[model samples]
Target: MRDGELLAFAEEERFVREKTAVNRYPAHAVKFCLEYGGIDITEVTSIAFGWNAQKYAFVSGGSQMEQFYDSLSKIYSKDVKTLASEKEILLRFQPERIESTLFQALSEVGIRVSKKSPTIQYFSHHHCHAASAFFCSGFASSSILTIDGSGEETCLALWEGRGSQIQITERVELPNSLGWLYSCFTEYLGFRPYRDEGKVMALAAYGRPDTNLERVFDKVTGLVESFPFYRVDPNYIFYGRHSYGRRFTDKLVTELGAPREPCFEVDQVSADIAYQLQKRLEDAVLSFLRHTLAKRPKNNLCLAGGVALNCKLNRVLATEQKEGLFEGFFIQPLSSDAGTALGAALLENYRIGLGRHVPLKHLYWGPNFSNDEISGVLRKSGVKYNRVSSVATEAAQLLSEGSVVAWFQGRAEAGPRALGNRSILANPTSSRHAEAVNLKLKRREPWRPFGSSMLLDAADDILIRSEAAPFMIQSFLVKDSFRKQIPAVVHIDGSTRPQTVTRENELLHEILEKFRDLTGMPLVLNTSFNGLNEPLVNTPDEAIETYLGSDLDALIIGEFVIKRNGTSPSDLDS
Candidate 1:
C-alpha cells in the first residue's frame, strides 16, 4: 500500500469485473477485510474507510454517490447486466443502501448478519492517500502533499509527518483540482479518462502547450492566473458529470477544438489536447510549489495521490528541489485508492495507539512463498532449471551479456511496481533491448522509458554525485560523463527513477554487486513483470504465465534459473 501501511487491503475493482465500479461504497472491499483478517464479526476494534464522503460533500457541496453513478455508467456503459449485477454486490456497501443490496449477499456467503452500521471510521480521502505514501517512504519526517482529481472535496492537501505523527498544514479542495482538469482533457482527447491519463502524460513530451488551460477552468471555477494547476476560486470546484456550476468552460473547446465524445480513437486532436494539458499542469505545479515551499522549504518532500503517479511532473519537482531547494523526495508506490486503505488504518493506529509516527524501512509487505514451493514450480513447469550455486552471479553474467530475465522471488509487492522480487531484469547498455521487450513481447508504449535498480553506494559516483535515492520515486539527472554506459534506463530528458539497492534488499543487492563485477556498472534496468492491464504475478503459475507469454529470455526464481527455447539466460532472442 502507499508507504507500506497495509497489513491488509483490497480494491472494489478486483471483486467486480466492471471497468471501474465507481461511486459504490466498497462492500466487497470490506468483505475481503473480514476474510483476510480472519476474525469474527465485531472482533476487530478498528476500521478505516478510504473516503470521508460526508465531510467532503459538506466541504465541496457536491454529491458523492451521484457522481459515482454518473461516472460509472458512462465509462462501463449503461448495460442492464451491469445494473443487474449491482444486486450481487456485497452487503458491506452502505451509507444506508447496504441494508437492501448487501444484506442478501452476506446471507448467500453464510454470514447470518443482522443489519447495523458497519464499524468503518473515515479519514479524508487524499489524507489517507498521502499518509499511506509517507508512512511507507522510510522517512521519519517530510513535507507531505496529496494532489489528485478532487477527493471527497479536497484536491490538494499539505501536511508534515514527524516520527509517527502527521499534521495537515494546508488543503485545496474541489473545483480547484488539477486531477479533474487533466481528466477533462483526457476526455476531450477521446481517451478513457481515468485509464488513459498516463498516455496523455506520454503524449505531452512530444508537443508544446497550445490550448489555454486557464481559459477552460475560468468559466466555472474562479480566476485561473497560474493556468491549469490551481485556480483562485473563492470555493472548490466539483467537475463530476452532474456538476452544474462550471469548473470547465465552453470557451476552452472553442480555443482548442470541439470537445470529444467518450471512447473516440486518439487522433491529432487528442495529442494536441494532451500537449496543452501536460504543459499547463507543470506550470500550475511550479506555481503551487513557489507558494508551498515558501512556508515549508524543507529539502525533502513526500507526495501521494493518483496525480502524483505522473513521472514527468515528478521530474520537474526533482530539478527544482535539487537547485538548492528540497534535498530529498519519496513518492508512494501505491499512490491511488487502494493505498488509502493502508493509510486510513495506519492513521488510526498512529492517532489512537502510539500517538507517534512510524518510520518506513522497506517495501516487501506482501505474501511470500517457501523455497520448497519455488522448487515445486520449476519441476512442474518441466523447464531445464536448477538451483544454482550463485544465482546473482549467474543472473548478472547473463544480463551483462544482454539477456532479459524475469526475476520472481519472495513476497509480491503491494502496489503497481515491481521493486525487485517481481521484476524483469535487463541490461542497461542499450535501448533496443527495452524496445524489443516493450513492442514485441510486453506490448507497452515505446515512448515510456523503464527504471533502474542500482546499489545504494554505487549510485553516488555514476548516476549522480552522492545522490542517495533509495526508492524509485524522484528522477535523477543522468550524469553527462557516463550517458552511454546505461542507455536502457535513461529517459529522453537524461534522467532515471533510480531504486537504490541496499542491504535491506539483500537479494537485490547481491544481484547488483554481481552485475557491477561482470559489466563494470552496478545498475540494471528493472520493470514490473506483468504485461498490460494484468496484476503482478503472485503465484508460481502466474510466474510461469509471464515467462512463457513474453519475449523474456530467462526465468529466475530464488536460486533457480530457467531458460526459454534453449536460449541461454545470457542472450537475447537474436
Candidate 2:
C-alpha cells in the first residue's frame, strides 16, 4: 500500500453474484491493487479488511469463527471424516482460515509474493463508512453521519472529521436503523429486499400516499421499550428472521395490505409504499440531523451509508439545508458497502497517522483502458468500427446529430454515478428524447430522470449548487431559466442530481468541452451504462454488448467509435 493508498473493495461486487458474500473475500480486487500499484507484497506495510468478524458476525460462544466452521461442516454432511477431525473442519471455515486461500487466488492472477504477507487487521464497518464520506468531503471539520442496515455492533454513527483525523461524536446501535425501515418498505412493495430499494424510490413520485404517514410512523419510531429507535430480538438473526429482517415485519404485513408478489407488475400499492418510505426516511433524517446540528456548530454535513444513496431523501435534506438547515452537502458517491473499502483504508491511515488527506475532486478512480486496449478488444471481437484520433469530438458530433451514444471514456467510475466512463450520452434539449430512451435503450421507469453532467464552469449557468456537487450527491433547483433547455435531466420537482465536471476530471471535462463546442450547451444527458435489469457495464465486453443491443446510434469505446448499422425506428417500413 502507498502512504495513503488504502485499496478497499467488497466481496459481492468482486464475485459479481453472491449474498452475504462476506464469506468469499476480495482476492481479485486485492490482486488488482497490488499489481496496479506495482508494489511488492513484502514492501506493503499494511493490509486491512473492511469487515470485522469480532464485531460483525463473531458470536460470543467463543469466536463465532469456530461456530461458523462447525455449522459449515454440516453442509458437507457426507464428509463424515470431518466429524472425526472437528478441529480441521473448524480451521477450514474461519475467514482467517482462508487467508492462505486469498494468497493462492492472487497468485493465480499473477500476483505472487511471499507467504508471510503484509500486516493485516480489520476496521469497524461504520468507522470506515464514516471515513469514506467525511474525509473525502473536503471538510476540515464537519459532523459526519452514517446510517445503514447494520455494521458491526452499530448501524448509525455520528462523527467529526477534523483535519486528517476523525472523532466519533455519537452512534445508534444495531436493530435501530432508518435504512432497515426503508428496506421494509421495499419488502412491502414486493421488491427484492436489498436490491430493489431504488425502484421503490423511483415509483414513489408516481403515486400519492394519501395515508397519514406521520401517524403510521408513530407505530415504531421513538423507542422499542429499552432500545433506541428500534430494537432487535437477539434470538433472531439480522434484527429478526434470516431470509426476512425484523419480527415486526409480520406486524408490518398486518398493518399494510398483503405485499405484492415479485414478477407481479408494479401497481398503485407499490407506488404508495414507495411514497411512504421516502416520506418517512426524510422525516427521520431531518429529526436525526436536527438533533445532530443542535449539538454542533458546523453547517456542513458528510453523508454516507446505504441510506445516503437515496437521492430523494438527499433532495429533501438539500431543501432543508437551503432553507438554512445545513450549510453544504458532501455525500460520498460510493456511500454504500462498496465504499467501506475506502473507509477501511482511511480508518487505518488515521489510526497510524500515516498519510496526507487527498480531497476527492471526482469519482473516476476505477480501472481505465487505453485506445490500444479498446482497439485490441475490437479486433479480437471482430466488431467493425471507425477508430478516431479525437474520440470526444467525434462522439459529440454524433450526439448533436441526435444519436444516442454509448460514451465510454477513461476509467470506469468508482461509484454508482457514471461520472465519466460507462455512460450513455444524449441531447437534453427534448423530453421526448428521454421518452425515446425509456421506450428503447434504458427501459427504466419514465419517472426516474436521467442525471445531468455539465462542464464545471457551466454548472452555475444551468443548475443550482453551482460549485460543490462534484460527487453528484445533492439535488439543486433547475435554474428556472435553463429548465426548458434541459428538461430531460430535471425531476418533476424541478430538482436534478448533477455531476459537476472539471479539469480535475480531465477526460470527462474534455468530453463535455467537445460537446459544448458542438452544441452551444455545456451539459450532456448521462445515465448508467446498464439497461433496465443489468448491472453497470464493468468490462469492455459488457459495454460493447450493451451498445450493439440497444438503440444507441454509436458507441465511442475508447478511441474506437462504432457507428450503428441498423434501420432507425423512424425508418421502419410500416
| Highest lDDT against the true fold, candidate | 2
| Model 2: per-residue Cα lDDT over 1-574, one tens digit each | 3777534332334235233344455666666566667766778767666667443233567564455444544542323333344445344445565567767766776767675676666877788888888877777777788888867556788888778777887888544667767676676566666677777777777667565654455565533332243442322222222223332244455455455664234476566656766776776667767766776675688888988888878877777777886786777788878888888777787677775565676666556677777777877877667755676677677777777888777756676677767788788888887886776588866677788888878887886656657767666778999998888888777877788887877766877888888878888888877766665676777788777788777777776767777322222110
- For candidate 1, the clash count comes to 15
Per-residue lDDT tens digits of candidate 1, residues 1-574? 1232344445554345233455554566566556655655545555566777453232243356445544545643333433443323322333345344544555555554544534657777877987787776777678888888767657888788777767888878544678877766676565667667877776665554443554554442332444233663322222222122233333344545566643223354455556666766777777776666776656468888988878778877767776855666777766867778778888877766633344555656555667688788767877676667677777888888777888887766655567898888898888877875675356766666788898888776776644665556566777887678788898766778788889888788999998888878888988878766666676677788778887788888876777765644443222
Candidates' TM-scores? 0.78, 0.83
Sliding window of 10 residues with minimal summed lDDT for model 1: 236-245
Cα error, residue 120 of model 2, in Å, equals: 2.2
Query: For candidate 1, what is the TM-score?
Result: 0.78
Candidate 2: which stretches are off by over 4 Å? Answer: 5-23, 56-114, 212-215, 222-248, 261-266, 325-328, 566-574
lDDT of each: 0.66, 0.68
* Model 2 weakest 10-residue run by lDDT: 234-243
Cα lDDT of candidate 2 equals 0.68
Model 1: lDDT to the true structure: 0.66
